[model samples]
Target: MQLILASKSPRRQELLTLMGVDFKVVLKDVDESYPQNLSPAEVAVFIAEKKARAFDEKIEENAIVLTADTIVCVDGLILGKPEGEEHAFEMLSLLSGRKHEVITGVALLQNQKIHSFYEISEVYFKSLEAADIRKYIEDCKPFDKAGAYGIQEWPGLVAIERINGSYTNVVGLPTHRVYQELQKLK
Candidate 1:
């Protein structure tokens, strides 16, 4: 039985490696769109499960396949990856001086069945000025991240005031919870 990871996210790979999991990375494309009625948390789980399903055919009997999706939510709205520099600016500006939630949903497919879970983290940002936003955009240019920011990068030092949950969840994976769940499968 193989342990496969169905994702292309480097952060997820890094976290998995940190846990000493011997796994193979195989990219699986999945529709990220969700029903309009679904909340941001639900959307994350839905997408993660969708990703896991993409690997159904390739899984060996008794193998464990993992997939996950992450999203940033502010005031009930989902903030996805920025389309461009201008969009990054807008996301960062909207997150300024406010509290937002980061949700990550994970799927573990094993024994021909799927198990899923989600984690939510609260983040509070200090007020940011246009200069601050521009400097971050030019410096870190966190265009690849959700909400146009990476909590482990430059803006993380200057913009974040407090966090009420898993710090790694903001980085893209919830390592602690993931570890605990995988141990059960072992």
Candidate 2:
């Protein structure tokens, strides 16, 4: 079956490649907003499914389309991508010396059928100094990352104390799980 990834995130693309999947990137503008009544996990799944719906009429019988959304949740609050440098700083400050959940929701669409699942990884950050945060913001400029951080980047190398779940989930995709699901689809 032909595989189509419906996202523009480089991290997700890299993870899929590392999983040994030969796929093509198909970009679609998806509305990411969710209802206020949904839980963090629900929100992630909802957005992922929403993205997949964009290809409902376009997917071919022999093509499988994959869509995913990742979010950082702390105390039931969802932290999305940072808007600016100061926002990034604020997000890092909130995450300092705390354990937060990174949830990535994935949807596989083929021939109008959709299967959705989510993976949650717990990430713990060490106590961060203001200077260290500033340096990371200045150097990395992580405006496109959720919670203003990327688990595979410089800030993650220095700030992350430990993780309790799939490391690749924290990076954006749960590669092992994705591979398993893809095999099932085949």
Best by TM-score: 2
Clashing pairs in 1: none
Q: How do the residues 127-184 of candidate 1 rate in per-residue lDDT, one tens digit apiece?
A: 9999889888988878778899988787788789999999999888899998888888
TM-score of each: 0.95, 0.98
Number of backbone-clashing residue pairs for each candidate, in the order shown: 0, 0
Q: Give the poorly placed runs of model 1, Cα more than 4 Å off.
A: none
Which tens-of-lDDT digit does each residue in 125-175 have in candidate 2?
999999989898898889888999998787578889889999999999999
lDDT of 1 at 186: 76
